[model samples]
Target: MQNQKTIITVTGYKGGVGKSTTAVHLGTFFGSRFRTLLVDADPNRTAVSWSKRGSLPFQVADERQAFKLINEAELVIIDTPARPDSDDLKELAKGCDLLILPTKPDIVSLEPMLEMVKDLGDANYRTLLTVVPPYPSKEGETLQKELSEGGIPVFKTMVRRTVGFERAAMAGVSVRDVDNRFKSAWDDYVSLGNEILELLNK
Candidate 1:
């Protein structure tokens, strides 16, 4: 393994915003090219359960095993729990190379994400819009504008809402493992993954 390890933390202020989903797929993306590990840092152990149930291509471990694996893999993606306290945020920010805040377009997710960043202070982080409408909608565009105007760093690619994710979850597989019916959804994550890789290279 290389001495340079990249720690990517996928976290959010609220739950069900696709944090685990992002962590899983992003780990898959990186695992394709580099040695990658996904850590179930969330007490819910969603990633660990998903990996056990699904045919994930990468390694998944509980939070307890994260430290040892981080040193071994080229990239480590962490699926964090919702609404971590200030101290936890500080700790995460201190340790991670990149912080990914996955959120939906609605206010239920938006408002808390804004507040959550305040706790992070100056973390190297960016917001990823998830569960967006597939078709063009004013809400998604407006939310992007608002986040931009508020000086929030956001990803250009948005993960649209699709039943494919639900199907993949039920089958214990990733969107990539699902059939062609979920191509669009899978492509969305691919685009997002590419964008993240670009950022990492920079």
Candidate 2:
């Protein structure tokens, strides 16, 4: 089979929605099957720092020279900053296979995320719910229902609110890299990786 380059940008209009976590783990998971590169496009450089801390297997680089570096890997996952400008957003979205938008299942996060979808105009994108309560939350259920009813594509696998995610981040490792204490959260990310791959294969 011929080598194919796949670019996935993980972004959201608002901050604190688990964009970095998703990018880090997704890149790591993709690395298991393909040569993968994780780009820290956020001015914060969170992904670069996390890789340094976790000693991730995949290569992590600053957003500079993205196209040149993309030639080095089959999959490229970008961790973007919050509230990027229109021109920058368009440039980032250009030619990307998937624009993965992470959002919390609440009005506070949902409103801005929806606004971002509008701002980005038409593009290949999917909304992944993050920081969801483990218990049945009316807001979460309602938001999922609303998005589905509106014909918006949402991930069937949601990332739950877990202290393990924070702990794993502090240790500079993906949830799966952490000990069994973080197994549940790690499992969720693995499931997410499978779902994303399935979607991309379609």
Candidate 3:
């Protein structure tokens, strides 16, 4: 059965593709507009750690704590363990309102996401290209075009590589709360959050 609450699951075949970061930012985005809850299911407990460091507008809990907190939440974002096998991938796809696959702009990151989509069946999902190299290099856009031409559903927003995210994490806040140099980085996610809202509404 589909979940009544709007749920998004972040996962990928490769690790360190910013899965937890995506989950955290997405949570903060929706949290301001709704009662959001971020569930940390990853073994690393990255999201859990982030919550402890700073003050977030929304509440965060581990997988176990999520059960009690979920019903009260209007939006729920799950940060799953990375490198899920095919079976787990299918299950994760089936369980959410949307499945987000975060990957860097490269063959290695792209390949796993491509493989996962092959098995999505009818799942509502989108690929987010992140940590894209900044200007003077169109690598991010180039990769996005190639993926779209190849028929993958990709978000228009590409998160540029920046250290602002790290500082925000250390301070337990969203990218917007960080340094001015990271403005573009935070804007990337703001654009991403808008795209997501549009997709779900449609």
Which run of 10 residues does model 3 get worst, by summed lDDT?
1-10
Best by lDDT: 3
Candidate 3 segments exceeding 4 Å error:
1-4
Clashes of each: 1, 1, 0
If both were scored by lDDT, which would come out higher, candidate 2 or candidate 3? Answer: 3
Candidate 2 residue runs with Cα over 4 Å from true position = 65-68
TM-scores for all predictions: 0.94, 0.92, 0.95
lDDT of 3 by residue, 41-131 (tens): 9999999999899887788999998889988888889999998988999899888989999999988888888888899877898899988
1-202: candidate 1 lDDT, tens digit per residue: 2568888998888888999989988987778878899989789988888877868888899878877776778888888888888788889888889999999999899899888888876678999999998775767777888888988988888888988888887777888888998898889888988898788773
lDDT of 2 at 128: 92
Q: Which pairs of residues clash in candidate 3, taking residues 3 or more apart in a chain or in different chains?
A: none
The model with the greater lDDT, 1 or 2, is 1
How accurate locally is residue 111 in candidate 3, as Cα lDDT from 0 to 100? Answer: 84
Local accuracy by lDDT, each model: 0.85, 0.83, 0.88
